[model samples]
Target: MLNQDVLRNARSPGRGFAAAKRGFDIAVALLALPAVLGVAAVLLLLNPIANRGPLFFVQARMGRNCKRFTIVKFRTMSAGQPEGGPAPRGPDDPVEDERITPLGRMLRRARIDELPQFFNVLSGDMSVIGPRPDVWDHAIHYLDSVPGYRARHTLRPGITGLAQVRGGYAEGIRATVQKTREDLAYIDGLSPRMELYILLRTVQVVFTGKGAR
Candidate 1:
């Protein structure tokens, strides 16, 4: 029988899975905070001249069940455009090539810019592993454009996910669609082993700078 309870089935998790996942997310976030803070301290000291903008870039993102929450990241691009500032950046939001500071490029390459999301994990806004959240505006668009995208939010967003490790960050509509499919597939097969694989794969991606835009 199909679980009929669509949302519950959408998550498709086993007994205590959600609880276990949350516990792990909390543990990891707590343990990692010191390192994140240490790096942030270094970046703070250097931001004045090297980055030339806010130390952190915060934007609203779509969370599980399509709720909105603030997502935090290290500022990796120059601010203050003549027109205004940067626009709402969605998943794989493409920034101007020239706007990427040399330091930002290194952070992106090493995936260090994502460290701030550990706070989101602690706050219950996100998980350690799942689909990366979409920018609120863009997620609204995708909810209308992409089939099965709503299901992607059955679980909290993650700093890393299967699509992210496999395809990198998505840019265009075609890529977003593919990413959505992979996210859904991850949900359908949610398990301990799969999470471990994603964690392991994420390490490789970080080390190799693969799948990063």
Candidate 2:
């Protein structure tokens, strides 16, 4: 039988952990805010000529326990499109190649598109470490296709994590499942030390421009 009680107990420590992580996030975000905001402002200024309209975009995403929250990102596509043309997919999705704007492509390559998520972290809708969030549409789709997909939601979503550093955009169900395993592995070993390791690796990867679209 499924040990719901054990799983429930597993999260009893989360409230304390969440408080600690929030403090850490606030400290880091405050330290990085000047730089982060500068970069985002520069990008917004350039976007008019590059991508055009809407400095930031928000979409409904699923978070812990399948709760809904709006995710923020730099707009990387033209504002106008045919109704129901195509939904935003993962970075690796073939459709992404078609819908992304020229300047949007560059934003994604440099990960500038994700800059707005810092606010999400500060707001406690996300974290600096954990599995990435998915749009509710994608979440629904994955729940049907991938085993234990919801397990990743045991904690808040993150801007960077084992999955992002390992395999940027899930290639397919197999890849997604693999990423889920990594997320679960992280959950099993969650700690400040382990999170520091993941964060360090994430910084290394970002600087080196590795495993990014």
Best by TM-score: 1
Segments of candidate 2 deviating more than 4 angstroms: 1-15, 81-93
Candidate 2 matches the true fold with a TM-score of 0.84
List TM-score per model, in order. 0.90, 0.84
Tell me how candidate 2 scores on lDDT.
Answer: 0.73
Query: Which residue pairs in candidate 2 have backbone atoms (N, alpha carbon, C) closer than 3 angstroms, thus clashing?
Result: none
How well does candidate 1 score on lDDT at residue 54? 80
- Return the TM-score for candidate 1, rounded to 2 decimals: 0.90
Cα-based lDDT at residue 118, candidate 1: 98
Relative to the true structure, candidate 1 has a C-alpha RMSD (angstroms) of 3.9
- Model 2, position 126: C-alpha lDDT score: 87
lDDT of 2 by residue, 121-166 (tens): 8888988788888767667777777666777788888888888887
